[model samples]
Target: MEQNRCEKSTLLLSVVIGVALHGSYSTLFNPLTGPWSIFPLISLVLAVYCLYQRYLNQPMTDGMPKLIFSFFLLGLFGYNAYLKTSNPEMGSNFFSSVCIVIIAYGFIVKLNSVNVYVNRKKTLRKHRKQSNINCYQLLVVNTARF
Candidate 1:
């Protein structure tokens, strides 16, 4: 579980960094004439792969909402890719910023939600244990009184 979390966090960071850099330089560096267009292409392909995992593997998990986020980001990424290709001059930081922030915030929200769930389970277990002990004590006292 920890390993999966670390790997996911790393992947999200990489995508965010890539988006930010691509947005910043895609204009000045003129990515259209070069191979840099591959960034969005790769992103879209990975998004498809992610969708496959979301539905093809098995019943979805609690983390399935994160996949929704990836799908949303992937859709936007495709749009940005189209705009960049169609009208290179129209590209702006707005698209890249939104994508990067969505990924970043999604990663954070997923992690925090998992943590909260784990903590809640732990708390419930503790409460149950204490209640069990109290019940046992009450039984003992009633038996003594009888």
Candidate 2:
């Protein structure tokens, strides 16, 4: 059950980042000046929440500074995308930005997945450690009796 919770949180992290980065880029390359800022801001907020949860719930994964910084890239991507669809003023530059955003999003998702998997694996290691301690005590007791 705990593992499931961790996995779910990790996936949610990806979704929020994906949306936020797209939104952020829209603000940059897009001449429309529409809702591009919302993506990065929203993504940052979610990232903050994750950090808060990290401190409050697990307290183990204390290395998310990179994740926090990545939000900026996400915002850039979102703003670029927004410009492409809204204002044709940016021209082909917007399209190229769009490609950049897509590639960035993919890499972000992959990185996030690896971090989550490591977190869960760490949990398993603790459980294994406890079992090993118990087995060693049992073995010593049997040998003493013999």
RMSD of each: 6.9, 7.3
- Give lDDT tens digits, candidate 2, residues 1-146: 88557645654565566555555555666546655455577666777578567657763344354544454455455555555556666565556576666758866886798889989999989989998998999999999999
TM-score of each: 0.52, 0.41
Off by over 4 Å in 1: 1-54, 63-68, 71-90
* lDDT per residue as tens, model 1, 1-146: 86566445444544454454444355447646445555655654664565456456545455555555564565447446655657757666567556756776776887798899999999999999999999999999999998
RMSD of 2: 7.3
* Clashing residue pairs for model 1: none
